[model samples]
Target: MPDLLTDRLLLRPWRESDLEPWAAMNADPEVRAQLGELLTREQSDAVVAGMRADFDARGFGWWALQVRATGEFVGRAGLDVVGADLPYTGVDVGWRLRRSAWGNGYATEAALACLAFAFDELALEEVVASTTVRNVRSQAVMRRIGMTRDPADDFEDPSVPEGPLRACVLYRKQAR
Candidate 1:
């Protein structure tokens, strides 16, 4: 897959050096606050492996986010197929930035790039983003990217145990 460039960020393929920071980010309590439990080093590396495989197979997957000026690894952003058996199914735009990377609008920037690639390059009809009902930060990014939400589209995430995180709200943006 080609690297996506924004005004200040470079969304490119994963690298071996990224594993260390990636694992550290996954272990941060605040960073994983809405993402469930922390991941071990092995689990984190496995996640990177899965993302790489997805990119090789589909030519589109989460890209390792980096700051262009300083070449700092920030996080990841891309499109992923919403799993089967979920209340809904389709491609979804997602972004996860390190705790230090927050408050800079990086998530919104990366998500907008993913949305453009989905609608313009991939020609996907629609893309959805779902998050825990309490995750207003991500929901804000969804809105900033022009996704609209319908209360009727909300559902309880079957994978998550019954709790606040189980209730998820979905937002969608159709190709224009």
Candidate 2:
């Protein structure tokens, strides 16, 4: 698939060349602290490969986010269906970026694009986003994009190991 461009960024499938930078960002302790576990280089490679395959198979997954002007690979943001076994199985929005990309509204921009795709192109019924209890930044983006908190929807991530951030705040927005 080709890249999905926003005004300032290019969201595309992962390429072999993206492995190093992706691994570095995923290895960052601060970034990994929020995103669950730090990925080893090999693990990162597998992740990139899996994302590529998933995109090919499903027509949508997290797209590698790149700065359009500089061509710098920032990170990724896109729509994913939470595991089928989970309560929420519809499109779910997500993002992760390098430390340098933080505080610049890229996450929100990329996420908005994904939501547009989900609601407009995919004709999805709804999109949900969740963040660790402590990840206020992510929670803020969810709110800024019009997702409303559904406290009843919040649940311990059956995926994350038991820990301080195991519980998550769930937010949802229905397609108009």
Candidate with maximal lDDT: 1
Task: State how far residue 15 of model 2 sits from its true place (Å).
Answer: 1.7
Candidate 2 lDDT tens digits, 38-71:
8999999998888888888889998999999999
Best by TM-score: 1
lDDT of 1 by residue, 1-176 (tens): 89999999999999999999999999999989888999999999999999999999998989999999999999999999998969898998999999999999999999999998999899999999999999999999999999999999999999998777889999999999
Model 2 stretches astray by more than 4 angstroms? none
lDDT computed for candidate 1 = 0.95
> What TM-score quantifies how close candidate 2 is to the native fold?
0.96
TM-scores for the candidates:
0.98, 0.96
Per-residue error at 90 for model 2, in Å? 1.3
- Show pairs that collide, candidate 1: none
lDDT of 2 at 142: 96
